[model samples]
Target: MSTIFLAVGLVLVVEGLAYALAPSFIRRMAEELPKLADEYLRIFGVAALAVGVGLVYLAQHL
Candidate 1:
């Protein structure tokens, strides 16, 4: 659907800006990611997923 494409496009734009505007910073974060524990990354991923879903719910209902 158009909504799904819009969401994907927005995500790509934000992701592109991070790399384009701060390539060095992005590389540094990528380098440090392997140093993080799996559990720590997993928890943060889950938290991000929850927040994203909550936002979509709010957008639809409110």
Candidate 2:
């Protein structure tokens, strides 16, 4: 559906902007990611997912 495409496009735009605007920062994060524990990363991922779902719900209702 169009909504799915739009969501993918928006994600790409935001991700692209991060790399374009702060290449070094992205690189540093990537470099340090491996040093992070699996548990912390899993928690971060779950938190991000929750926020993303909440945003989508708000956007749809509001």
Candidate 3:
């Protein structure tokens, strides 16, 4: 649908801007991710994945 296309396009735009403006910060975050404790990292990853799935479900229904 047009709305889905627009949403995807906006996401790409924002992501591109972030990469252009803060590439080093992004890399630093990635590099430091492994330093996080396993349990805490797993919890954070699972919560983020769950939230992403919930957003997709809501987008489809709405």
Clashes of each: 0, 0, 0
Across 1-62, the per-residue lDDT of candidate 2 in tens digits comes to 99999999999999999999999999999999999999999999999999999999999999
Give me the runs in candidate 2 sitting further than 4 Å from their true place.
Answer: none
CA lDDT, candidate 1, residue 21 = 100
At residue 54, candidate 2 shows an lDDT of: 99
Residue 51 lDDT in model 1?
96
Q: Each candidate: what lDDT? A: 0.97, 0.98, 0.91
In candidate 3, what are the lDDT values of residues 1-62, reduced to their tens digit? Answer: 99779878988998999999999999999999989999999999999889877988898899
Model 1 score (lDDT): 0.97
Clashes of 1: 0
Off by more than 4 A, model 3: 1-17
Q: Which candidate, 1 or 2, would have the higher lDDT against the true structure?
A: 2
> Model 3 reaches what TM-score against the true structure?
0.63
How far off is residue 52 in model 2, in Å? Answer: 0.1
Tens digits of per-residue lDDT for model 1, 1-62: 99999899988999999999999999999999999999999999999999999999998999
Error of 2 at 12 (Å): 0.2
